[model samples]
Target: EDKVVQSPLSLVVHEGDTVTLNCSYEVTNFRSLLWYKQEKKAPTFLFMLTSSGIEKKSGRLSSILDKKELSSILNITATQTGDSAIYLCASNSGTYKYIFGTGTRLKVLA
Candidate 1:
């Protein structure tokens, strides 16, 4: 069965701190790795890593994929209170369906 798992289901960090979120998965015919940030309602897409060595970054957030290791990492540098949100990782099996990991809730305090 295809599945994704994330460690440290929740985290608490102060402003200006950096955090790393880990996601490991096992899937069939893996196509891509997707990252999302969820504060309220549905999650918002952050990054999609398909090719290795090429990372996707936005502001203080960045992510990279390791196809061989079957894992992905999300890094947040100098986080702010606004960065407090749930970080989710999902794997696509070259199909319309995706396997989602148990997101990590990040709390960034001022």
Candidate 2:
């Protein structure tokens, strides 16, 4: 069975703090690892990493895939109060279906 797990289900951090979120998966034929950030409306696409070790970055957010370990991590640096959101991780198997994690809720206080 294909499945994904995200760590630290919830977190509280002060503004300017750096946070690392983890996601691990087990799939039949792994294709890619995906990251998303969800606020009030819809989830926004963060990154899709097919190659391991190479980090993807946008603004204060970055993510990396570890194919050998079947895992990935999302890092947020200099977090701001507006950075508070639910972060989601998904593993896409070659079968074209994605196994999503329950997500990690992050709260950033000023």
Candidate 3:
């Protein structure tokens, strides 16, 4: 079965701190890796990584994928309390279906 794993399952940091979240996967006929941030009920799309050596950034959040290592990383810089959320990583292949990883829960304290 294709699998995705994320490290440091949970984190707690002060309002101005930075955090790095990690994800690694193994899939057959690989397609892409996607990142999402879940704050309440729904998860918002963060990044879609299809090519290596390319970094995708939005505001204080950034992510990159490394196909050779079958891994990806998400970095959040100067995080605010509003940044607290569960970060999810998913992989897709063949049919637009997604295999998700166990999420990383982040708590940014004021």
Candidate 4:
């Protein structure tokens, strides 16, 4: 069975603080690792990593995957209160199915 694990299940930080979140997985026939941020409602797509050593960035968020280690990291720099959300990591392998991590709850205080 495929499994995704996220570190630091929760986090609390002040505005302007930087944080690093992690996701690791173990699965058969791994295809890709995806990152999403859930604020209030739906989970918004952040990044999809298929190749190692490539970093995907958007504004203050960035993520990178390490295929050799079967893990990925999400970095948020100078976080604002708006950045507070539940960060989720999922691994896709099977037919249109995904194995998701428990998620990391991040709270950024102003």
Candidate 5:
């Protein structure tokens, strides 16, 4: 069976704290890894990685994919209350089916 797993299902931190969220997967012929942040509106796309050893970043958020380990990491540095949201990790294989993790709920306090 194919699946994606995310660690530290929930987190609470101060405004300036750094947080690392993990996602591991086991799928045949993995194609890509995607990250999203869900807030009051809808889930916003954060990144998509098709290759390993490369980091995709935007502002205070960054993510890396490790093909060998079949895992990915999402890092948020100097977080703010506005950064609080439910992070989602998803993976797809050769087929067009995506398997997603339950998500990591992050709460940044002021």
Candidate 6:
């Protein structure tokens, strides 16, 4: 079965804390790895790592993919209250469907 799992289902950090989120997966045919931030309604794309582009970085967020290890990681530096949101990790199978992990709920205290 294809699946994605995230560690530390929830986290609480004060302002200026650097946090790391982990995501591991097992899939039949992995096409890509995606990271999303879920604050409301729907998740917004944060990063997308594929064979052509295995690393993606944006501002305070960065992510990398390891095809051999079948895992990925998301790092957030200098977290603020505005960064408090659910971080989701998903694996895109070749079939165009994504298998998503439950997500890590980050709570940044002011």
Scored by TM-score, the top model is 4
Tens digit of per-residue lDDT, candidate 1, span 12-102: 9999999999999999888899999999878999999999878888989999999889889999999999999999999998758799999
Instruction: Tell me the tens digit of each residue's lDDT in model 4 across 1-110.
Output: 67899998999999999999999999899999999999889999999999999999999999999999999999999999999999999999978879999999999999
Candidate 2's residue-wise lDDT over 59-110, tens digit each?
9999999988989999999999999999999988866699999999999999
Candidate 6 at 50: error in angstroms? 1.1
- 93 in model 5: Cα distance from truth in Å? 1.3
List, residue by residue over 1-94, the lDDT tens digit for candidate 5.
9999999999999999999999999988789999999998889999999899899999999999999999999999999999999999999886
Worst 10 residues of 5 by lDDT: 91-100
Error of 2 at 29 (Å): 1.0
lDDT string for model 6 (1-110, tens) is 88899988999999999999999999887888899999976899999898643668899998888877888889999998999999999999877689999999999999
Give each model's whole-structure lDDT: 0.93, 0.94, 0.94, 0.96, 0.95, 0.90
How many clashing pairs in candidate 5? 0
Off by over 4 Å in 3: none
For every candidate, C-alpha RMSD to the true structure in Å: 0.8, 0.9, 0.8, 0.7, 0.9, 1.5
Model 4 residue 36 CA deviation in Å: 0.5
Name the runs in model 6 displaced over 4 angstroms: 52-54
Where does model 2 exceed 4 Å of error? none
- In candidate 1, clashing pairs total 0
Tell me how many residue pairs clash in candidate 4. 0
Candidate 5 has what TM-score?
Answer: 0.96
**Which lDDT tens digits does candidate 3 get at residues 1-110?**
88999988999999889899999999998899999999888999999999998999999999999999999999999999999999999999868778899999999999
Worst 10 residues of 4 by lDDT: 91-100
Winner on TM-score (3 vs 6): 3
